[model samples]
Target chain A: MNPVGRIGLIVTVTAVAIHFTGVAYAQADFEGIWNPQHPPRMGQPDPASVRLTPEGQAEYESYGPDKDPTLRCLMPGIPLGLVDPYPLEIVQQDHQILLLYEHFHQVRRIFMDGREAPDHWLPSIGGYSTGHWEGETLVVRTTLMSPDNYTWTNGFPYSGDEDAYVIERYRRDGDELTFTGEVHDPRYYEEPYVVNGRWNFAPDGEIWEYECIPEFGGIQ
Target chain B: MLFIGFSATAHHNGATYFDISTELEHSDATVVSYDLVNPHGRLVYVFMDDEGNEVEWRAELPSANNARRRGLGGDLFRPGDRLTALTGSPSRSGANFMRLTRVLFANGDVAQITGRNAGVVRAGTE
Candidate 1:
């Protein structure tokens, strides 16, 4: 059970906060300053990504969806790399915005500068994301993500390691901004997986300083 | 401190604490180096570095082929088939507790280790 789910206030406060942002938050407006938070809860499961082959099913069954190796501050590997349950700062400059997740001091620098991705050797974690603006929407295509699907403790399997791609269409509809992510992993996936995630920009906040120290336990 | 979550977690590399690094400068003990005696049964232990160079140590760990030994990834050794291995030591002088992150051999070879079992409690000189 989610700790904050009991409060009921977080949902109200978060929704109200999103409501006050006026109209919708466009990509350029959100490019400057933003704080991201993922409270502990079982959000909507993307069934589109759930369709896997027998081998893929085996991998996903090995662990639950929340495979948090970093629970004890262990090494954070593929998947939980960005979807950490904490507030992160998103700093946008020109076409580039930096995503800094607080789980284990992990940060990913996304390039909006239209450069071609390298050869077939990029490993997935956050993957390689390049963004482009279409009117008020920021369209980002992320490739090179390592495929397996148990980032923390959850054992959800992505389609495949080599052929997975995420097309994130970020739209700011007034105070409520929506991020529609499409996952395409060809090996195990028979079709394109889609997820429409929504968020509110918290300007009245600061990204909490999170540090993971596992030297003694060496858990991280 | 692993965090738990369900569906929709971006399946990327979960954060590991190895890179962030810790200060680890604790002033809790009055003296620095204290002897570590085993609280459990006797243990045959050896202190090895990353290069597998055996360093002089107090505890005695058993052989790798021992019936009670378990291997973590990269040749890390564990006793009792669990992440926490209780090696053979004398009485309690101090404790050498370690997380199951990595283990070093007498020849200085290092292996991955984890679990919060390596402890070194401070002991007042008898």
Candidate 2:
């Protein structure tokens, strides 16, 4: 190769290597068993603060406790799973981060390899999560969530379509971890629904198995 | 030690089945059976009413894993075990159902099953 070409190639490789090294050093250590400081509220938004669309209001009014997905042993999904009262273990890796929850043994994978969601990806309870580090905070964006029939703590209904998305920021400080999330569903709400929660590091905490059995007899 | 507080409406809506605003106490209750299962634990017992009728009731306790963390074992209560006082919230629909909060054994031991007073199981004097 020519001298100029070799110089340009060496400079490009060095810049890419420095960028990756910076990301590695800037990554915060969130690896630990975290116990929620407060009981899980199932990502319930205050009805007074939430401005729902006409369709959303109708769905909310029609919600009943019997329609809860958890009663049928289905995963609560996304923000609900994230804020569950059970302990969760965060396993950080180069390509992805794994969130192992004790609530029904749900596992969430947050890809950090800069891959975009596929066009024809199937919607699911946990959805698809892509995470990137911004300073010391881990920012996660999830999309393509299935609109399962479930009611929030205050009877607010989840009626979003596949376009519904959630953005979360996880910040770790010492032994405390704070989380803030915003749910965006233009079809359901006029504004993004916001929620906040916190967790404390449990050095001796361990995730226990959660076995759920649906009570068909009790379902009416 | 991390103490996970038990919410009455944790898994499902407690208000739909339970009259959470009121508390009921059943004295001298006899255990019919105890099932340590998921979603919630079931404690079936029979108690004599004011009319001298033996009425069977079902009390929903915390999940088995939560009970274990609170020092309660699967074999804690067996059939025919006598309880001095079994306290909980009664069903809103007037069914034979309850949301268990505490259990006082005949031997003077106390087990605070749920709510703010949970996680305390005192030794019996006997």
* Top candidate by DockQ: 2
Chain B TM-score, structure 2: 0.83
lDDT of 2 at A30: 93
Stretches > 4 Å off in candidate 1: A1-27, A32-42, A46-49, A64-67, A72-82, A148-152, A213-220, B1-126
lDDT of 2: 0.75
The local lDDT score (0 to 100) that residue B9 gets in candidate 1 is 23
lDDT of 2 by residue, B63-101 (tens): 777777777778879999999988887766668788888
Q: For model 2, which pairs clash?
A: none
Q: Give the number of the best model, judged by lDDT.
A: 2
lDDT of 1 by residue, B13-125 (tens): 21121111221111111111221111111222343444656533322221111111234221233332121222221112223421122333333343322222322222231
TM-score of chain A of each: 0.68, 0.85
Docking class of 2: acceptable
Weakest ten-residue segment in model 2 chain B by summed lDDT: B1-10
**TM-score list, all predictions:** 0.48, 0.84
